[model samples]
Target chain A: SQKIEQNSEALNIQEGKTATLTCNYTNYSPAYLQWYRQDPGRGPVFLLLIRENEKEKRKERLKVTFDTTLKQSLFHITASQPADSATYLCALDILMDTGRRALTFGSGTRLQVQP
Target chain B: EPEVTQTPSHQVTQMGQEVILRCVPISNHLYFYWYRQILGQKVEFLVSFYNNEISEKSEIFDDQFSVERPDGSNFTLKIRSTKLEDSAMYFCASRYSPQSSYNEQFFGPGTRLTVL
Candidate 1:
């Protein structure tokens, strides 16, 4: 079975500091890896998606690095603010032999930015 | 900016009762999906609908569960007999295309279902 793990259940960091979260997976070679932000009582919002060949992707204050060889991906939120506090999830896109695609999500890492 | 929308922000139903969750995906999106998240658990995929048929479904979506896109704009998930374990947040998502470069799924606010 394919498994995706976001190791840290929760992380607390001071405002303006960089918060790095980790995602690791096994038993599958995904075509794309994605990150999403989910607030309590709300659905997840799409953040970024990096292809297998892409090493790193950046959008504003967020940066995500994918290392296929290590079967790990790192999510970084730089100069974080209190508003950036939320549960961040990493998902891998699996393309089945039937030509269908599905996203398998990690347990997610909750980040709390303290002021 | 377009977004997926779900009805009834919260639903409370008795065990063994039937419940229908409705969603209106982004107008132009071709791919629709249903996902559920139990309290403190990861989001789990239920089913994916495309071209007016089920493209894929997870094991959790058992015989008691069914999906329908009765109308062009409305997608629905129905649970024939809700169980206590069915209590969770149901989310609807849509994507414009399946192409890797344009496949970011946009999720709805989600409907909290409480089965007692």
Candidate 2:
């Protein structure tokens, strides 16, 4: 079985600082990885994705780096704001026989930005 | 931008009762999905629908659970008999072909199901 472990600790950082979240996986290597942001009582919103071949991907204030050899990925939110406080999740693309269209998600790390 | 919309942001039902959560995905997207998240747990995939049929489903999507796209605009998940463990937030998502975009998914507001 595959398991993705993300830091369960709530991170508290000052606004404008860089926030780095880590995701580590065990078992099969994934073809692709994704990051999403979720607020309380809300669905996750897609952030960025990096393929096994890609080292890094970026979108505005967010950046994602994947190291397949290490079986880990890092999600960074730079110039963070109070509004950026939310749980960040990492998911790996899975192919379960039914044909590859689903993702296996991690527990997610909660972030708290203080202004 | 077109968005996926779900009905009854919150629903409460008794155990063993049938519940149908409805969603209207973005008009032009070719893929649709259903995912559930138990409070404080990781989001789990339920099923995926495309071309008016089930493309993939998870173990959690047992016989008691079913999905249907009755019309051109509506996508639905029906739970034959709601269980107390069925309490969770159900989300509807849509996406265009991987060739068209970065495989990004657009999610709905989610319907919170509370089984008593």
Candidate 3:
């Protein structure tokens, strides 16, 4: 069985600061990992994805790093704003021996950027 | 930009009653998936449908759940004799073929199912 754990249940940071969230997994090696932003009462929106062979990927203000050796990925949002407050979820794409592929999500970390 | 859509944003049903959640995936997507998230919990995958048949399913998608692509644009999930534990927000997702660079699954708004 595979398991994923996020760093914290909630994080509070001042606006204009950088927010870093962690996602650690065990028992499985995924080919790719993705990050999503989920607002209250809404479905998750995809953000960034980093493949195992890649060390880092960035999109605008967001960046993601994948360390396959440590089975960990970090998500960072610089210059955070109150509007950036939302739950961040990390998901991994698992390809089974049966040729089935599924995305498994972690519990997620809620980030609050206050002014 | 195309997106997945689901109907009945919120549904309340009795413990023994049946409920059908509907979804219309992106027109060109070939892989469809069903997932559920209990309040305050992580989203859990239920089933995946491809080629008009079930390709994979999780243990949570037991005998009580069934999925169908009865029409060209509609995908549905039916829960027979729902239980209290079935209360959760059900989400429908779809994506292009795995070979495509845009393989990310697009999720619908989700139908909140509450079984009393």
Best by DockQ: 3
What's the TM-score, to 2 decimals, of chain B in model 2? 0.95
Off by over 4 Å in 2: B98-102
Q: State the lDDT of candidate 2 residue by residue for B15-110, as single tens digits.
A: 999999999999998899999999888899999888888989999999999999999999999999999999999999998875645587889999
Candidate 2 lDDT, tens digit per residue, A1-115? 7889997668999999999999999995788899999999998998998988999999999999999989999999999999999999999987677556588899899999999
In the range B1-116, model 1's lDDT, one tens digit per residue, is 88899998999999999999999999999999999999999999989998999999888999999999999899999999999999999999998985545579999999999999
Chain A accuracy as TM-score for every candidate? 0.96, 0.94, 0.97
Question: Better model by TM-score, 1 or 2?
Answer: 1
Q: Write the per-residue lDDT of candidate 3 for residues A8-107, one digit (tens) a residue.
A: 8999999999999999999878888999999998998989988889999999999999999999999999999999999999999988666877899999
Error of 2 at B114 (Å): 0.7
Better of 1 and 2 by DockQ: 1
The CAPRI quality class of candidate 2 comes to high
Off by over 4 Å in 1: A97-99, B98-101
CAPRI tier for the interface of model 1: high
**Sequence-dependent TM-score of model 2:** 0.96
